[model samples]
Target: MILDIYKDALEYSAKDWKTLVILGVMCLFSFLLLPVFLITGYNYRVINTAVHGIINGRDPLPDFEDLIDMFVDGVKVVIVQVMYLIVPVIVFVIFAIVAGHFNGGLSTALMIIGGLITFILIIVACLMSQMGLCHMAYNDGAFSKAFALSEIKEVIEEIGWSECLMTYLGLVIITVVIASVVSIIIGAIFTVFGISGFALGVNASGVFLLGAFINSIVSMFIVGPYLSIFNARSMGLLYTMQI
Candidate 1:
């Protein structure tokens, strides 16, 4: 099932080169801020499509129309993410306070326990947010549906907790490996050329050098958006599995 999800996601992302390039351009201009919303909005469309397509059959990547609606959906996506993040933040703050009240070995023990608990909470928050985004898409962008924790939990149960966690952990692992490889490649290019200021993305001329250009090209147009869309498609398909 996981293999099929990835296979479908990869093919779906490349179904239309024009749409893919448009997404890439949006990512390239994402620093402008407005494009960020559009990018997120597009992701929402992909997930929504994936969920619905489970029965109706998959469609090509969604076209970039309806800018206003996309922006609103993007905002909802961000809100859902921030809402999920709050759980871990609250847990961390509480742990800090409780740990502060203790001293000596007890304090040390409390701190370690708090750290572990916080780590687990962070992972759980991330997993839940993924489901929350899918749930929001599954429900036609209902703002409250993203926060429907009970519904989300029930969906996860239907998917089976172990399978869900392992799938997410696999994503995390793959992401880490890709990021590490990109970093190493960038570092090697910088080191081999003995380039200075290239790493900073500009020199006295204030122009992008080889390293920065490659990094920007890879991140903005290539790897980053592909991964984002891929993730959305994968999770959306996973959400459909609950059916």
Candidate 2:
């Protein structure tokens, strides 16, 4: 089922090159803040379309439209995410602050325990945030529905917790592998070019800097949006499974 979801997601996202490029450009300027939210809103749209398509037997990719609404929805998505993350973040910060006051093995052990707890909390937060966003989409973008804990739990239970965990873990591993490979390839290409220039008496620093700049651009404009859409589509498909 996970494999099928990814297969379809890749095909679905790549079908429209124009839309993909538009998304990539938005991702490139995402540091401006507005574009990032618009992208988030688009992801919400994808989830909505995916759910409807599952029921209607045809899920199509959504187009960019209604900027105001997309921005608003994106803000809602951010709020839902921030709310879900607040507890873990607070716990981690407070624990670190308190632990710093002690100077001994006990402090080190406490810090380790704090790190472990914080890690667990972050994982849980991410799981809940994804499910919450899907729920909000399914509920027709009702902001409150995203926080419906009981319904969220029922949704997870229906999907089977173990399967969902493995599915998400698969997604994470795939994403990390792709990122790592891209970084290595970029670094290697840049190093080769830098070495060649250095041997010719050209400054290696400039070559390395140019490589870093290009890699950053590629990551922000291409890799980031592509992965975002893939994950969004996968989540949309995952939500559709409950139907």
Candidate 3:
């Protein structure tokens, strides 16, 4: 199933360059602010507002003064997402009913299981991607890897359950500490020069934008490929452990 998804992605890549480019652009537009938050400071509301603006076709750019205003607006976005969760539940129920009616018995059960697994895989993939990105952002050498079954198995075997949990926790803590320190240093430099100083002297905003662009590049070139490789490695590790 995991390999099938990778194959589908690869086939999609080969057949749909235009779609890929559009996807890349959309991802860039939507997530460009993420690194900024990491580097500056995290305000959940600020992050929410940025995501809201991107989704709503509003300009997501922050003027220094509007930052507070945007943060305030972010709360509303959170409420909206909470409300939207109901729609998915309704859709899932409807689909399950239809499947039961048409297929019944073993086929329906298998279909349900497949859907569950697919959903789980997607969620795991996203979590792994986030973890990999955080690791890379802090360590520079930590590349993004795909959360393949093989990779998952490898992680379980080499690290074991206990060690895996500890490693992930450690990584999270380290990422937060590093990002905090970087933000403080950058903030101090900006303060010394002032916004005007920033405007005149290589603007912190420019640096922020450049870092986002670099991150996108890394995601595409390094993270995406490494994910595929890691998935295979994880499977191998899992097999070895099982044996």
Candidate 4:
């Protein structure tokens, strides 16, 4: 009966400021290539923990330790994601190239069709891949478990395709809202300060630019982990209902 995924995640995260801080720092550094893998792994780790919670009747938000294991798991998730989407991406690229060479209305039509196909395929791939990821985590990171199409389809069927679609749509809407709010707030801060700086003097503008950078980083540190946790928790809840 949880009506609000974002609210639930916010409360869960608020329970432990120390852990949130650690996750924030980790998220801030995750942009680097090496840590990117770990960050990816952490995503799976969150899903794994969520699955564990549903199955075991334990607390869902597990501690953000075990970087090495999370990194390894993350690499596998990356592979799953790539394998799922590569075909559609290739097709999209080919169509894009063809569209580029064409003229007028034909090119416009081709581009539109190509873009639509790519968008649909990407959504399908992500949903299926996520199911695969959840399964893989639940089964202890066996790479093969992630691609068990027959079993995965059964779970989807049991959950009802309509419900699954609704869940995906809901997830998208929630994520977009969260991301938009964060982006707007940060953007507004920068714009206001930046304008004031310019109005004051060149030196003030420099200071405002510096302040904007700091603000962006700090906002990222706060919002990034919160969204990650919210997503992980929401996915866990989704699968938990199926069981």
- The TM-score leader among the candidates is 2
The TM-score that candidate 2 achieves is 0.89
Ranking by TM-score: 2, 1, 4, 3
Question: TM-score for model 4?
Answer: 0.82
Model 4 residue runs over 4 Å out of place are 1-7, 55-60, 97-101, 186-207
Error of 4 at 199 (Å): 7.6
Q: Indicate whether candidate 1 or candidate 4 has the larger lDDT.
A: 1
How would you encode candidate 2's per-residue C-alpha lDDT over 1-243 as one tens digit per residue?
A: 888887777677666666767888888788899998999888888877776665234566787878999999989988998999999999988889988999898788888999899988888788888888898889888899899989988888898887677777777887888777897899899999999989999889888988898888777666766677778877777877777
User: How does each model score on TM-score?
Assistant: 0.83, 0.89, 0.25, 0.82
Give candidate 1 misplaced runs (Cα > 4 Å): 17-20, 55-58, 182-209
User: Where's the lowest-lDDT run of ten residues in candidate 1?
Assistant: 199-208
- Evaluated with lDDT, which candidate comes out highest? 2
Off by over 4 Å in 3: 1-91, 94-204
- lDDT rank, highest first? 2, 1, 4, 3
Report the Cα lDDT for candidate 4. 0.73
- 10 residues in a row with least lDDT, candidate 4: 1-10
Better of 3 and 4 by TM-score: 4
Candidate 1, residues 99-168, lDDT tens digits: the string is 7898888888887888898899888888899899889888878888888999999999999988888878
True-structure Cα RMSD, model 1: 4.5
